[model samples]
Target: MASKKHNDHYTDYFGITDKKVPFEDLDVHNDTRLFLDPHLVRLRTSPRPYWDQAVKCLDTFLETLTVRVLSRNEDPGDLLKHIQEPPETHLGMARHGYRGHAASDVIAQRIWESLTTDLYSLFRVGLLEHIEDLPLFVRGIDRDITSDITTRVFFDSLAQFTMSCMRQIPELSSRGTIQIEKTVWDPSHKQWAQRTYTVPKNNDGSGIILIPRGWVRKRLLGSASRFLQTETLTYIQHSRAQYDHRGKLVTPSKKTLRKELAKEPHQANIFYTEAAKRNRQNLIAQFWQYVDERYTEKGPNLGDGLARP
Candidate 1:
């Protein structure tokens, strides 16, 4: 009976009585298909919410770093430092096994090439406003990389958040000594610093960083696929449509647009990139980001949906 037991969740393995815990019921053994979303992060306005301070740290640091890099005034060391593999939060899509946040010097190289070399006109026209937007308009950037950057920026706060949640669990509280040390952005100092945090132990004794149940979705807010299908296609539907002989404008349905865009991924990328560059004043990043946010506020969805509209 013991050998035949099937445990799919941490609670099942740990025998947690409270099934409706505040934090997500993560699988310590594998990566869950979820991402720590910044849109949701900003919605946390509960008095004394830990995320409020973290938002400043994250946005300011990412914008500053990107600006400095674009201006050719940034140090190579800082760029390399910013591109780091974040500790596993047990959230995100991972193949083979659950390696939460992953990136290396190669990603740093790609980012450098993207900013200075890639023909991403969106960056030059000022539409590439947020860090999350990189994956949308910039080639070689992916959700995994964005998720890594987000976790790194919110590292210390996540640790603190984990500690705060630990008190609500008896097993976690018993072992809550804040013993793990990791590098994180210190909002107080406006720089990265080392910090210790108490994390829930995995079955094999590894630490698991827990995110709030409402803080994640199946994909990041600026998901390329979702943005392409929704905002990008909507733009194409209007701009690409023509007037009939009766002088009435004809618009293609989403299904028709989707089928057209599905012909070639690169063709769709070029279409949206041009569309975004053309309507700089109208096609803002916040618009698309918010759409993903509102669709996922109900919490993480275990689906690979492109979040139409």
Candidate 2:
């Protein structure tokens, strides 16, 4: 049986929640509701296409802020204290910025990776193990329904992961409209470096929604697809539009987001939801064949005698 629950938590507490609430009635697709995890946005690995640009962006962004703040001769702790004060809350150091200590940077990197990639990696591995063990439970399920249920379980776990990452990265929120939010202070410029985004409104009453830039949408979703079903993966990608550049998120699109947003949620309950119907059907078919082969009179029933008198 699928665990029906996962170790993941809501992305809002991490300072990523959608700013604009969509209307009650618009039909929104699942893919448009996503956002990236800030923790996962980092300098790329060596020899990669974006590696140079990634390094330049990070170094420039960090250096610009550090030089300005260092001029104060203020202790790091005092700076944290001063910036943390109310009214100027907008100017403080967020989890994504350089906080002046190598150790802090290392720790932050660990935390970032653990929450975003590490968490999902573990979840996927666990799911694979569960799927491998699923045959044990399939015997109790109906021939017509087992595969469908298991596949739904598989995709639902992926969807949950997508919802989570959408809440982590802020840029996916304002895909078409340019809005800049100052995230870190720059002493040299006597100002702040703002993160920019593009937001577009839907024709329906649901109002403004975020979409990923053409390129980003292609990349992350491409990566997510290998482990998930096509439509289910696309739905997760579309939901990514929840994050705007400032690391603040927006509400997810209603159609796809509702399952994750439900009260007293059971992650497995998603298998029973309408959104998962097709995938569930596919799952049912796939597992049914396995059950037939393994439990039939000629097939192995490795555990059959152990439970009998």
Candidate 3:
């Protein structure tokens, strides 16, 4: 009872290829043998997490397209009618063995047109609303993956696709030239203040300095524990070797250091030294300050009355 043409269109849109290999027969390491292109085959065993995230971004973009652009009357099943219909290349050709390369190209082009139009509209809305939509946009791109290609190869193709589309947007292309200043906590003043350096609009380099809170805690605690262990070992060893050339103990301070090290590392008189506490507090304060500066919305600054007389 289903229309054959409709079925074909759905299959093509979803990229349901004729390859009959069952899931049980598929193996990640052996996937190289599945593709026709040698370059694509090489990506069979490539890092998956990175590609998975990339695919997720693509998926998100497609989801946005479906939700924001598609009409209520149309379903994904109607994709064939929307796509630029490909020409019939081979007469009397069996559909199973013959790869519709030209048809694939047409489908890809139409999808790109749809994606670019929707993405540009989304960008315009975000600009007008003064909203930070880059994260959501990136997530949108990561959400739509209906491909059978290997993770690495798929991401490589996706990167090229995204780059091609983004190159057409002038605003996004000029993003690298724009810079904004971020505020930070000034330890000396004990108040929030603007940073001297301006960061790029894209904020690509911020990752190097903006460490996660959990990572900071782990690193700080780990370093403190290691330092305590080393100092404790050093004090115990020094106490035994503190005797003078005449075999009489001259440095009586070793006993005091040993007693101090014997207390719990977090105790006020022991490992919780003033320097250590100050360093920890500074790290925490800086992290919170960074969060406030990056996430908090500041009131608009009204320009000082006309011009000074």
Candidate 4:
């Protein structure tokens, strides 16, 4: 006799045969490349209290981190309290994503050092309003890394968010729950703490979550993609721009811009950051607006992604 075949998709397990589900109906068997974006969280409308709590958890820690990094003297231990390997929510693009992935120590230390050194210097000239923008200037950080950090810092809120989602759907809420432990921050006591939440779990025993479609993008709004599109690029263009005899702007080709960007004198974070500061107000507004208008899909179901012949 053959063993029973179960659906790996959350909706399928929950008996949903609909073409589309409101939340991200995740593939419970493996990790997806989608990221949990904070910008989208702020814009979310459903599950009001959960989104609010998620925002609070994220902001409280990030604000503290910014202040600590700016202080340049305090031990980063408290601020880094919740910085650790995130519990696999079966959401992210790790190489072996279902197993979960994150650089435990080096990333934490590097972010701390950058905040104190390079980022602090950049702040003096012009500050990025969203820490989500760090990947553009920070050497090795990317969306996946930030997503991991977000999951670690805001685990409880997300767990609760999942709770809210599960309760709203009958098939899931009726399925009962499993208890799981996650390391999180104790904002009141100013330390790290272990916390537990009852949530739906995978056969692999990892907890699963359904992110709101509104609170995610197929590709996150990353600084690497948008950095130059902002006024910063205008600044870079002007600085490297050639002038006609009459002082008319001479547009540089992409090739020219690349060559200039590669040159030693033009390679420092200072030049770009300084230019960014010149239009700081506009830069902040434009980036958020770009997030609002682009990428976030309205109506579609994510296919199983494992396409084959």
Give the number of the best model, judged by TM-score. Answer: 4
Judge candidate 3 at residue 1 and give its lDDT.
14
Q: Write the per-residue lDDT of candidate 4 for residues 70-183, one digit (tens) a residue.
A: 778645875664555454466666444366656567677777777777677665544555556566567656667777676776677777777776776666654456887877
For candidate 2, lDDT tens digit of each residue in 20-74? 4211111122111112211122211322333333333334433432443334322
List per-candidate RMSD values in Å. 4.3, 23.8, 26.0, 6.0
Which tens-of-lDDT digit does each residue in 270-296 have in candidate 3?
222223333433222232233234323
Better model by lDDT, 1 or 4? 1
**Model 1, position 167: C-alpha lDDT score:** 71
| Residue 161 displacement in candidate 1 (angstroms) | 1.0
Model 1, 1-309: lDDT tens digits are 012134367666556778887677876567767767665566554323666766877777766656656676434455447556554586666643465336777777667765654534554566665666566655556666766777788777777777777776766544333367788777666677777776776654567777766776666666556667766677777777989999999988878877877655444654566665666634445455556566556444424454555
In terms of lDDT, which candidate is strongest?
1
- Would you list the C-alpha lDDT of every candidate in the order shown? 0.63, 0.27, 0.27, 0.61
lDDT of 3 at 217: 11
User: Least lDDT summed over 10 consecutive residues: which range in candidate 2?
Assistant: 82-91
User: TM-score per candidate, in order?
Assistant: 0.77, 0.19, 0.19, 0.79
Poorest stretch of ten by lDDT in candidate 3: 207-216
Off by over 4 Å in 3: 1-174, 177-181, 187-190, 195-198, 203-222, 239-309
